[model samples]
Target: MSATVKPRYQQLKDMIIERISSGELRPADRVPSENELVELMKVSRMTANRALRELTDEGYVTRMAGRGTYVSDFRAKSHLLEVHNIADEITRRGHQHSCKVLRQSRQRSRGKIAGALHVEQGVDLFHLLLVHYENGMPIQVEDRHVVADFAPDCLSQDFRTITPSAYLTKISPLQEAEQVVRAVQPNAAVRRRLRMADDEPSLVVIRRTWSHGRPVTFARLHHPGNRYELTGHYSPPGTPKSATGNVVELEIYDHE
Candidate 1:
């Protein structure tokens, strides 16, 4: 399979960001209008609009009701936590990454689905179900829900070529996220899809990602316990050996 390519909108975003990084697009400088971008990049109007809208949402640009868009006095936010892309991880491990998209559709959120995305009940949303593979072996099953408004083009992407994770990151940079990890037995269908033994449990990570102060995506990611392992390293402040330490320190915050 051909290597996954960055979406056109993301390419446009990268171009503008590179300009900003190189000091060509200074803060408060007028950014090219959507029409200008359409003419310059040869992308569709929808593509130009999405790129700019996402840039505004990500604080890379500011848009005025009447005036044109302009570069913002943007301060990049540090990622308090890192969310690794599965495809990148697989490639780093010298393995091929691929996925099968099982379900992709729009639906109304109900019950826990609504609560998970932090949206009102019955809000229309996009749902995706995928089974990820490493070297042709199934490793994970991901069930994801995205806020429809945040990703208007969610339904059109050919997910078999690009992962939902990669696509969503381009929608808007992650502002915040919450995660819950658990070990449990998944449903028979998922277990079979992962090729797990009947007695094996699954390692599950339930994640909710926020952008522009709104939860935009909620996902349940499951891995076969027998074949998958979770690893991490912690480098705390002022620790000489922390950089290479395998021990992770967890912080507990008081409700007060």
Candidate 2:
């Protein structure tokens, strides 16, 4: 069976998002008006209007009453849930964040990874192994893979200075994402990477993200179970939808 094609308005939305991800359209920059898009893209005014209207509703752009629309100063967020960059999360908490790049290379997708990336086996992909630190203490082990076609220069990035999450999101903003939180005992290598105790469990967040309807990146973010957590807060059904997005809070529990 053939895959379903997206509507023209959705295509227009994706194009605008791609531009934003590439830094071609910076936050607060003026976006082309509906009339301009209709003329530039050769689409009907209705299509252009729907695209701009949806973008505004999704917080990607803000339409002024009198002035033109402008790109919103918003960080890229996932569709299912928020995926915070470790560096940004730490910085937001007023702590220093750093990382160590343990590995960066090209590898062929195999087994579950092939399916996870929505690519065939033996397809070449970029891989990175990193450990993130907060306030000088190791906190997260990030093992990630990127589809070669989506981010061809993934290997050249210095993850020690900029995290894979930050770099990838900038390359192709997330259109969709899924994450599974797990509690399990990690292997010796992962245990050593996060500097966890022998009996300590690991809090792992397995994530797969998509852009343009294809899965482009897969990651396993592991942390010391005793030290990290994720919590969610959503408005009740009766409450109005937030102009921003869902609220996700991170808490640290340092065990002795």
Candidate 2 weakest lDDT stretch, 10 residues: 231-240
Off by over 4 Å in 1: 1-83, 237-256
TM-score of 1: 0.62
Estimate, for each residue in 1-256, the C-alpha lDDT of model 2 and write its tens digit.
4778977888898898789879999999999988899888999999998988888887788998779999987666443445577888899889999898888999999999999998999999998888899998999999999998889888888888888888888987756888898999999999988788999999899999999999999999999987877654543222236745856554447797
* Cα lDDT for residue 90, candidate 2: 93
lDDT of each: 0.86, 0.85
* Superposition error at 74 for model 2 (Å): 29
Residue 17's lDDT within candidate 2 is 79
Candidate 2 segments exceeding 4 Å error: 1-83, 236-256
